[model samples]
Target: MVAGERLKDRYAVDHLPLSHQGMGEVWPARDTVLDRQVIVKLTASSVMDAALAKRFRREARLTARLAHPGVPAVYDFGQHKGRFYMVMQRIEGIDLADLIAEHDPLPVSWVAAIGAQISSVLIAARQIRLVHRDIKPSNAMLERSGAVKVLDFGLAAIHGDDRYSRITQSGDSLGTVGYMAPEQIEGSPTDHRTDLYGLGATLFDLLTGRPPFDGPTPTATVWHQLQTSPPRPAALRPEVPAVIDDLVHALMARHPQDRPPSAAAVYEVLAPLARNLPPIPGVVSDQPDAIRAYAAMVGQVPLPAHHETRDSTTAEYDDPDLATRQAEARAQQLATTGNPRAAARQWRELADRRASQFGEQDAAVADYRLRAIRLHAEIGEHSRALRQLHSLLQDRIAVDGAGHPTVQAIQDEIAKLTQGGLDRSER
Candidate 1:
């Protein structure tokens, strides 16, 4: 589905607005029957096949049977005008990917908590003989109340089914390049352990702000997954606790047998670091606490020093405070240590707190926002930085008009990103 295109003349689902795209376009709509907001996922048949459609419907039914707090409730499923669609509870909150992209290399506790919660969901699915063939960050969504939801059961199947073997093989080569397991890349039979590997990849991306392996092509990426042993998460960031490092490596072992036997086991490992009791298989825990953990970890960091001139127009920017000065010093120290991921994380926290304490319109708020954007870009959070830049540019343009210098600068950055101006380190 193209960006900015509106869906027309749909009755059961109203107000269809395209929300995102990759495998398909997700639209936010109201289910008139249920009188609730829902997400309808639509994909062009040319890009999807009959086998894939069957898998989608089957997974939807399987998901409907699941009553876990971490899984989105599937409401309806059908086809219309040759476009396949499924209506599900509208998920809220950013995906872990977006969180990491907005704020890179999240804190150890945050990563562990999210990993444990998602793993717990898988553990529940395992009881019903379902395996989430795909477990990347894109499939995870945060709820408005702050709980995480594991989504996109489009690739899921009953544990032993070979019905999707052919399509899964084809699709595996095309999607989620950085998270596939060796067995998956080899087109071998997959089990719950395959999902574990993907979960590990997801966690690694959150903590290091980058996938352990990257390649110029999908083939090359598969080769690295098959042959490489990525550095332990803490090796990249020494401050990461020892338990997390050991657990992540164990989950990411090249061989399936080497990983924890089940998601329940992974949750067990994460429990202590998370400092919480394990989630009951199907119960929803209080969400505020989870949000606090998330806020603490992916929370925006502080901005570096801005060479302030006497800006008499804005009271907030007239002078810097001791807090801002101290934050700037801390940012510089982290950046200079060659651990920009850590630096980015720190800046995010300070920035978020400052924004709350001050006001959104404050010049200091804008400064912190810009600093977080630049640091995220430097730390390899391209999608996340792009979103932040878009929001900032929109607000600045609204207040200062399209021709303002700040607006122009933002446009220039967007153009550079679109043209691939920034260089990513060779992995």
Candidate 2:
């Protein structure tokens, strides 16, 4: 391929890729059809394994599903000359890794802002059941507008989808060293929390000008990720706050269960620290950024309410059973209309009523409790969800043996919630 060489007679790409890594190469291209500069990533022909091709296609589809400003928009996907290529919105900025190299020990507020932005993206990704398995600094771009865009979902995994085979065999790790969580290094089942650990390591690097752990060899580095705890950020930079240090440590906890409950929870802690950000000399401009200004206005828009109250004089529920049925109907209406917060509240109330009318251990009451838990989780209320799950688990274990499938399913939910930082105490 050469400069001006057209792929599918539409995208004219440069002769050489902008960057080439192990699995693929990213090229700068002009989409003649759309008349825009876009990024085209192609899998390396030498390593075009069937599974890899499937994963590449999966990445394109998964990335396309994410509709957030923090993520690049996918434009097209097709095969040219037996190689798969995906076109995405071109992001003009330096990656976080390069930014860190040029300006290490970045301003504290800048680090907080970047982390918080990434967390905001993660919150969206988690809700959609997508996990970015690779989340190192190189996978994050810092635009001139000071917005952080997370890239590289090539290794992303969908929750509970096993149609695609595992990329790594037993005992083989897949992510970049230093950023891999302990479970990742051990080849254990992973979830959204894995990304949090990577974010923690990246933030540590940004604050200290070096990775939290670096060994003489890759094998040694993997070992450190599995067995060692990183040094405190305050130790390297005295200006670091104790609260920030603690948050970073919790994020990098050896056990996933020890980390914060969710990305939303992490954002809550970082939002206050992200104030008064100091601009990077070259990366962030001093002039007012139109993207930032536009985003501020868009975020302030309120979502339309889905719930409406009926007048007491016109209400028709005269009996307890009828009122319970009406409440359940309202809860379902709210849930289907995309208002999980109000839906969760209604479900909880229904569960309480069911428990009082029948019994705490009644099957109908348990069902209502489960619905409440599901609705809470849909709205990023993992802490509340975990509390309800624990209650359901006790009832389940009493009715079924510990090894029973239903009992085990509840246990799995508990583990996932806790590992993502939503333990019983969080309630």
Candidate 3:
């Protein structure tokens, strides 16, 4: 929240903030261990209800699942002083919104390239059954290498994952009015093709320097998207190829079933046109980008067979139950065995991993960390036990406030740990 302040005692806040959006503020930061620049996004406030916290946790899991060059990497999800924070790779690029403004009606090739790049990301998302509900221009970044990085998974959802936390009230759905699909605007169930409609609107903007359907007010804009036929980009910008025009209309079809079957199918059409992109003067840098070269080689690899999962929530994340359950179960078994230190280490690792997911303020994190301290104390590592106890106490106080019951409980635990003892539950 302030310059020079640190989150998790690892990420040092480098500046005030890069920008502020609807959910919270985005700050520029540095990862001390990796020695790399990162961006930290925080919630508007530390106080969030159960639903909001669930949504925040789901967003972190959702974005982390979308591992791709086109998506910014998520580093850590945490909390400090009750504020939930998401640490992500800091992508340097001009927003597509700004790019469109500076060079309205971008060259036909660039339009194809941008649309193709966006479609490529959507293709990746569709593979995992993830729907990026919001796919407008501002949510995309045109990198120096001329590649587009799809940004903001805040509105993303996985298909068949009906347990998603509601980000809005009962009737209100969150989305950009001009770009939302008819079903999305109507609060009807949405899927991958929903994102295709948004892509159509984005490409329409890139081609004609305006949204496909516009009106004087947001209400009117919603009506246009819901009722009016998608405008032909070629009619507004004669230079737009008719092939591209037909593709855009297909993507923005009123019925989801009528849109392009898949984002990959859409990409197949746009990729050929994306060739030989001439760089824009100020928008794209002349510097050689290693990622671009690496991507060229990656393109040659054969695509995996498309998977259509019905019950899965995340795309293709490694089995956490296999990873977490086995480790914790083994740790529990190891607790009564000859090696106490190894068990302690296992508990500590679980604590750290969960801390990365839920933050240090989490009760489960405190529980496992306390287990580690208890084992350390049992093994006569008194100093280490005391240190961890004190650290947990500090975090509890920060998150729960000084006078809260949990803080008081943590204070008592620290006192007991210093005295070479722990509660029966901790033991």
Error of 2 at 172 (Å): 7.7
lDDT per model vs. reference: 0.69, 0.80, 0.81
* Residues 1-427, model 1: lDDT tens digits: 4333333333244444555454466777765544677778776566677655765666566678667878988877777667777778887677877777876756677677788789878877765456677888878975555467898776666554354333442534423777877777776878778888889888888889987677889779878888888558787888988887887888889999898777777887775676543432222345456665765675366534773212211222223255568887888798888877677766777767664443243445566667767777777678888898899888877766888777788888777765554453332
Show the colliding residue pairs in model 3: none
Q: Quote model 2's TM-score.
A: 0.71
How should the candidates be ordered by lDDT, best one leading?
Answer: 3, 2, 1
Q: Which sections of candidate 2 miss by over 4 Å?
A: 168-173, 299-427
Worst window of 10 by summed lDDT in candidate 3: 309-318
Model 2: per-residue lDDT, tens digit, 302-380? 7558522122111321132567788989999999998888887898888886654333545667677778787787678
lDDT of 1 at 120: 75
Q: What overall lDDT, based on C-alpha atoms, would model 2 receive against the true structure?
A: 0.80
Ranking by TM-score: 2, 3, 1
Q: Higher-TM-score candidate among 1 and 3?
A: 3
- The residue pairs found clashing in candidate 2 are 260-421, 261-421
